[model samples]
Target: MNRKVIITCALTGAGDTTGRSEHVPVTPQQIAESGIAAAKAGATVVHVHVRDPETGQGSRETAFYVEAVDRIRESGVDVIINTTAGMGGDLYLDPHDPTTFVEGTDLVSGVERLKHVEKVMPDICTLDCGSLNFGEGSLVYVSTPDMLREGAKRIQDLGVRCEMEIFDTGHLWFANTLVEEGLIDAPPLYQLCMDIPYGAPADSSLLASMVAQLPEGAHWASFALGRMQFPWVAQSVLLGGHVRVGLEDNLYLSKGVKATNAQLADRAKTIVEAMGSSVATPDEAREMLNLRPRS
Candidate 1:
């Protein structure tokens, strides 16, 4: 395909992957540096998820966002900042009594989740479309209909482009509902996340089916976890969508070889170019996704 594909590098996620790889940036400074490197390596957008510096767990603190955004801006790299508003919804339930919340639970209202976004005012933000069993456990990532509506309205009000994260077909359905209800703006964005357990599996046909279900004029991207990350880059482009890659979804550039955020971004850029598609610049991405210019 001869198109300008926007490459997004997810710097760090909230998952407990710090123990698995030392490359996962835990502090705000590290996250900023990693994102800057990715941008330098050809990523147009950097998806951010700050972690607690002390504990290495995911944090929704505005201070973390402030520091990370500040550092990235101060570095003068032209990359779109896309922060995660998907935090504060993790609900690890008690195995015996599902009604009772467990130690890992961090459930909160959708409004609370956007507090960081409201403060930082990034170029783009994520809105997970619906609830799902996140992993192989009782941890249901809760984002109810009411919560989604409230979140979508708030993200719109903030003037941040909302990238609707679709982990399953139902999530995609509700995302369409949000768009139909006018909660989402024109050129709505979607991210098809696959193979996270108990949700949609990593299958190209399923991706095509979901792509067919998307609303008209919608811009979308798709990704699978772990080893499937690079392949999904080609898969997404072949299907006329963008691609995402980083340490957030996968830890290795190759088997038994660890990868950095910049390395993953470089590899993704090479893949996109090898497939006869040029990678979009930050400004081009902004234009294509209808995002506001970086301020």
Candidate 2:
């Protein structure tokens, strides 16, 4: 066997894709069920983000995470849980008034975003490296250096691994800074988010360059949006990193076909295996990422 690749299935995201695809999980029960289904389909980890049941928008509620995580644990499925601490940073400014915060803006302090992570204490939680133009609009996903340092310290104190989310090269630089400052624990993990609008483009050369910049002993994964999701699996593995896929970054298994979280994980498993790399089990993934032993 070549390398054992860990596959993470991101169940539901905070994107506006809920109406676009009926398969996007909206409620806490659905999120937990999707995670369980993905785990059974050979996913080593499940990245979770809760949505408001009434509005289907992403929420920062601690109770939602508590229930979702508890349900996953109660199901007895063996899979690592990775929750998103990237919420509460969405800032949508009015195009007319640049200084004014708009209705879509959800900006909050770095510590505020980790309320769910604090409550559930997942195996891993994401810490977006920096702010960036979030799409083809006035929305900017803000994560300042101060916010990052604070969040990194909080996550470090929790003993949960922080999976630094890298949207661009500059974000990668700041992530390395956090590592250098000793805020991040050993075996730092990175998630290279590609093709998400104004962030890093989905280019193999860029991915290679980014991987080369990772710190020694760092565990990493790369993912792209929509059509590139599965192809990037091969791209990430070839670069000696892991892989992530699911309804969060993508909504389809193929063109015009909506996908469930399980379907996406199964496809990723096939791609990783076809490349002569075996998929890591949950325990194997815990070892690879240096996660704290399950409590």
lDDT (Cα, tens digit) per residue for candidate 2, span 34-95: 99999999899999999999999999999999999999999999999999999999889989
- Local error of candidate 2 at 195, Å? 0.4
Model 1's alpha-carbon lDDT is 0.94
Looking at model 2, the pairs that clash are none
Kindly provide the TM-score of model 2 when superposed on the true structure, using C-alpha atoms. Answer: 0.98
lDDT over C-alpha atoms for residue 293 of model 1:
66
Superposed model 2: Cα runs more than 4 Å off: none
Stretches off by above 4 angstroms in model 1 are none
Instruction: For each candidate, give its TM-score against the true structure.
Output: 0.98, 0.98
| Candidate 1 lDDT over residue span 114-134, tens digit each | 999988899999999999987
